[model samples]
Target: MTSEAPLPKPSFMNALITFGLIVVVISYGLFFLKVNLHSLMLICLMIAGISASLLTRCDFSTIRHAMSEGVSRALGAIFVFILIGVLIAAFIQAGTVSALIYYGLQFLTPSMLLPAGLILCSLMSVATGTSWGTAGTAGVVLVGVGGAMNIPLPLVAGVVVSGACFGDKISPLSDTTILAAISSRTDLYDHIRSMMYTTGPAFLIVLLVFWLLGQQYAGNALPSSQLLLMSNALNNAYIINAWCLLPFLVMLGLSIARVAAEPAMLLSSVIAVLIAVFMQDAEIVNVLTALYSGGGPGQTGVAMLDELLGRGGIAAMMWTLSLGLMALSLGGILYKFGFLQVLITTALRRVTSVFNLVVVTILSVFAGNLTMGEAYLSITLGGQLFSDAYDERGVNRSVLSRSLEEGGTLTAPLIPWTTGGAFMSATLGVNVLDYAPWALLNWLNPLLGMLFAFFGIAIFKPQAAPSANHSTPTDVSFKSVN
Candidate 1:
């Protein structure tokens, strides 16, 4: 048998070609006709094959080997995704989330409506470590109430999502927050504390905007009788007390202590389950069932309580976990093929200054959100790409990290196909595009990153300029606003 010629070395041009082919295939598969995920997977494999053959000048076996390695690396993240789902499901089954909502609704009225709604959603999002959960639960009800009060759904949804996302972005227990810290090798609590500098401002601005809107929409207080009616409606649905808040407080405290995310969440889940059993006398078998579907049999007479309480199980997380793994696998293939290296190198060549670097990083993250459709990818990939650049320039890692969070983590929800976007859409019944503009934090983040960079705000580093001739600065003083 004749021996085949050796493959050529991969180049930027080849990487570009590979990326183009992948993009075209995805666009065609997703848009041109309805295709199942299996078909999509096959399409990806075929595209990878063609790209490898032409771009890498490699044999099918070599390409397959790289692809297998890439797919294997994603298993860990897939498991975490499943656990996150289980945690959410457990919280729901235990009536932890419902109890919080029921108590909040008791105080909501036309007078304190806007601030209360914003704060309530923010609190829920912070408690759950998920804006999607907050939006799906309290967000939907707020919209219904808005409609009842003859208010605009889009505007209301916008405020609700804004508040929820703000909480998610800042909350220490947030998955995105955990991912950012881990990806950047920073302490989770430190990162969260650092984020508060910008997050606080952003949150205040969003609240103020919502408050002004409320002034116009919140016409008059629902009379005392109506308030009482609302209270009765809440009371009739579910029993509420201090115990309901324990799981959230425990989770938040653990998170603040910089505890590992999975354990903290698991512990919180356990507390929720125990609370449900002891306080609510929730059925154990029913709790197990609800962990998958995000729904379980609640009380028959109380529609609101049943609907609110019956949500989020392990089954609910499967789709997200599967998609996350698939994206990771695809990303891994691209990385192993040297596509990411080529892209980063090309992007880095143009960045001659901090301003440009900030801009590029922001754009790259937003692009990832648009492409990969997930905040975790955006934060992780952005950190991977930009961390070294920032370090070389004598900039603090926190600056680059916070920028990634602002650009990548918070903005994924604006994309319709993104994990956050899909979760929010499914939960709130609001189109991604509909609330995109109103998601003040999402849009403001990149702007803040750029603004901070240009203004030299909060960028910690050695005072000496970076130059080959100059000796390295020995005294490193870390200064952060938070």
Candidate 2:
């Protein structure tokens, strides 16, 4: 009798289990120990090292292979991170970033300070498709102005970030928004429209919060004297004009036209660099240097502008890319071992009712964001794990997408170590917690999501009946299993 060959061990199942336990550990660490990203990353790597050593029982080569696989999975995100850095640097060296800031500063006055700050930053974020860029440039200037006016820095920074993130979250040009849609496998326009349900209210609420916050200093006029200083600084630094906005317009148009992100970003960077050469007679060496080092300034007197504009070089992105790789490596190791699937399976079994399913989905989405610390993965994985349950309950695709946005996209910046929070904090020079309380949109989001989930508000269902060909015809459909 031929003996059945022993089944090969299921690595993904084991990885899923490992991932779940690690998630628990990370969540506990964050909540109870208040650990930071460096610590969290180390903890995850150590756990992964131990797991591989014990479970794989493989030689050094095998272990290295597993780690390599994990890191390899991170390559795409790493490239994007580096590209963003290069783009930031190119724009700065190209003088586009500075010109935008100079024009923004031209309108700053204490009378409409908060509203103006919000509007300008929001506009910049929408234009650049990056809240971090907006925060780094215009946001920093607003903070300095607040300091000059003896206003609280954190509060001002919070308002600036609020507006910046709001615009970034909503704008079609935003990479994160694109990532969210792509990962969810939804139409970009559809995703944006669906997001408005949560995003619109959050933005209105945040605007109100800023307006109220600004009331304390409502009568204070912007100091006219500083405007001249700013103008002189801009005049001395680089040629500034409406013409500088062409590259930005091109980028924005490309995004609006639904062009893919990587190519669009690259093309925009090239356009910006070309403009820099023509307008400023920028040396080729400076262009190349800026690509790597966030722009080599010939001689810009405004230190703040220099700092703001001189950001986003390829070299500068290494830190973010490394961190992202570490996170993805840990995620891959967990997947390979069986952590995530196990939790999802177990959770699925336990959630019997629609309310329970909705609650669990919201919680799971939050958990994913918290554990993964990246919005793209959170939305993708969370949508994958929960979509079927929603369908079974006759829930809508929009609801699932809404939940992903609420718990995944909006909550990401609240986690200090999460990619969104880390990028924003690093870019804006504000602590995650410092802005957490003030990120009105972020805070209200999960609650609104959960509310809609439980109340069954705004949840849409497909009109057709289920046929043998369709899994759940009446259920709302998602673009992907994720």
Candidate 3:
């Protein structure tokens, strides 16, 4: 906690310089040098640590604690990452994924697939309040289906992400939703309501865009011959039937019932592995091997089917996990050293109106995501950073929370190094940059939010004067951001 153990306060200029230095490195390495995210993040971690030590003059022990605390805070997400890998492999082995593909092709057409997928993913994410789970399970199915239909995988991935994040932004079950509301000291439902005004419109627009674009690409559908080839390969490889769907149904049911994601996913994977061995007539040795390395050689002789099916496992997820760890540790150092704090504080001091406050809130959280390399930290700290400005301007707390989600929650997955981004890339098999252009809902919401703020549409009027005792939060120990 800053109140309990404050580091030497960093100057705004030093903080800005350090953050800029990191941005340059990330841009150069990510875009020009074409370095992998894991290596890029490692470089960043070292740079951040060194900068923090020089600017804040913090002891090595404090730096180590910050690094440890960063990863520790996100332990739940790390566990979920490992489980997602296991679940994907198990689902493929049990014919659950194969069954979906085999059956999905019977109904889904290239012309309507984008809009339909967006709606389905939206419903699932809302029900489960989990974007990652929705992306891992349903998103994977949609990507494979898109490929079978000869639709561009990046476009399909973008639509899937847009829909998955829609529920996460406004759903009551979402951790980011709850975190934003708590941080802003607003009612949970109030935060949700505020979000609906922007999220609803953005979602509809995204649906329309994908629909129109999908129509233009309908001609790209696979020839009937190729489609039949894929269908036959899947049919020959696994016992595709309704029984295969049971594992997914059970996982979805548990998630909607408020069971923890970890337990729900683990239980589902167990069922899937059992079905693979007994019902699918797969060898136990092969099943266990698939559980660790995704899978061995493909069951189907078709190159495309084999390629998609032969992915998942702990080893497959290591690239994402390692990158996320580096980013989190670097974020911990930045947060603890007060680099972000000084910059956000300086920015808040210049806010002069309610509209400015709203726009700043959105941009600050977006910047927080970039500098902190995670949405949780941005959402939590953005609340503390801007609550006073909103209070003084007579803006509703719900607006502040809505801004947090619009910026932090929506933008995190578009960045390549954030935990959200890494998970999406690993699960969906598309680079963030590739799909970012198509994930309209994620970017458009913030624009609409700012537009609404400008015209005063849906912006709540202040009902009372600013609280005299309102002050910066003292609970910013960074331990609770998760």
TM-score of each: 0.72, 0.78, 0.94
Query: 91-187 in candidate 3: lDDT tens per residue?
Result: 9899998988888888888999999999999999899889999998899999999987778898999999999999988877788888888898876
Q: What is the model-wide C-alpha lDDT for candidate 3? A: 0.85
lDDT per residue (tens digit) for residues 1-482 in model 2: 99843222335556565566667777787778887667778787777667666775655565455556655644555566666677677777777776766665555555456767777777766665666556655665576566545566667777777677776776766655665555544455666666787677767776776777777876564457766766677667778787677766666677556565467678988998888888878888878887987754655665655555556678775666566666666655554544555576677898876667666766776776665556666666766777677778786555666666666666776777666676666556567778788776677766776676567666667435323443221133221100
For model 3, state the Cα shift of residue 159 in Å: 0.3
Query: Taking the tens digit of each residue's C-alpha lDDT, what string does model 1 give over 1-482?
Result: 98955445457787667667766766676668755443564566676567767776667777767666654643444454555566666666555555555554455555456666788888867765666546654676676565445456666677777778777776765666666766765555556666777777777777787777777865754556754664565455445577867876786677556565557667888887787677767687766666667663445344544554454566665555555455545655565665655666788988999888878877777766654545665677778878889888887666666777887767777765555665565455566668777777667756776787788776677334334543221222211100
Winner of 1 and 2 under lDDT:
2
- Mark the 10 consecutive residues where model 2 has the least summed lDDT: 473-482
Better of 2 and 3 by lDDT: 3
Candidate 3, poorest ten consecutive residues by summed lDDT = 473-482
What are the candidates' C-alpha RMSDs? 6.7, 5.7, 3.9
CA lDDT, candidate 3, residue 398 = 88
Quick one: best lDDT, which candidate? 3
lDDT of all predictions, in order shown?
A: 0.64, 0.65, 0.85
- Ranking by TM-score, best first? 3, 2, 1
